[model samples]
Target: MNKIDYKSPIGLIEIEGSAEAVRSILFVERDEIVNTIHHETPEVLVDCLNQLDEYFRGERHVFTFPYHFEGTDFQQTVWNALTTIPYAETGSYKDIAVSIKNEKAVRAVGTANGKNKLSIVIPCHRIIGANGKLTGYAGGLWRKEWLLQHERTFNK
Candidate 1:
């Protein structure tokens, strides 16, 4: 797998993937940044970085690059549902459960959401508490708030 670190507006982002498809994109601390020399970066990783740049600049709302998700079927289902949420919009765990035709799986939906490896691209940050409050985000609530605010600003 190939990996690269990008300094994003929020923090450092680590993107991992192969030439075929992007495997994961997650936030990392400064210390977590890997030190490795790549002879040549893959085209896909470079493309993802450009798209991310566009996203942070508020010039792009959707990601069109190729990506791969590795998780259980339930997790994949939840991730797929997350993508359906329009840019700058939010959804609740209960809402996702109902969308998947499993209204009783609200808690399960939350669990699956936390397991999401791909961050902004998969849009796990868009999920919120049913009460309309910001909830748990693997990337931290502050970053989630920043992302929401960022999108809201650009959505206009």
Candidate 2:
């Protein structure tokens, strides 16, 4: 897999995959967040950096890049539904299941949300808990709060 890194106010972001798709976008681990980008990065990372800059700067809300992910059919369905969630708008896990027409799959939706490797680019942070409380976020609850708050502060 092709891997690349770039700097962000949030930290060093690692983008991985080929031109046909971006497979993952994640912050370096918390311990590595502040670490300088150490790997030799791919030239293909330029688009990732551009899109990410726009995202953080609030000039862009929706991503135009093509992405490829590996997951079960159900996980893919849930992730696609996540993209439909408007930036700056919060949805519940139940909301996601309803949108996917699988109200009984709320737990599965939550599981998929946790498995989201593309992270903020896929906008999983938009999902809240049943009672609107923040729930499981693989990137860490504080980062999740920061991302959702960032979008609300600057969403177009």
For model 1, give the 10-residue run with minimal summed lDDT. 31-40
Candidates' lDDT values, in order? 0.91, 0.81
TM match of model 1 to true structure: 0.95
Off by over 4 Å in 1: 31-39
**For model 1, what is the alpha-carbon lDDT of residue 40?**
79
Model number with the top TM-score: 1
In order, what is each prediction's RMSD in angstroms?
1.5, 2.7
> Which stretches of candidate 2 lie above 4 Å from their native place?
30-44
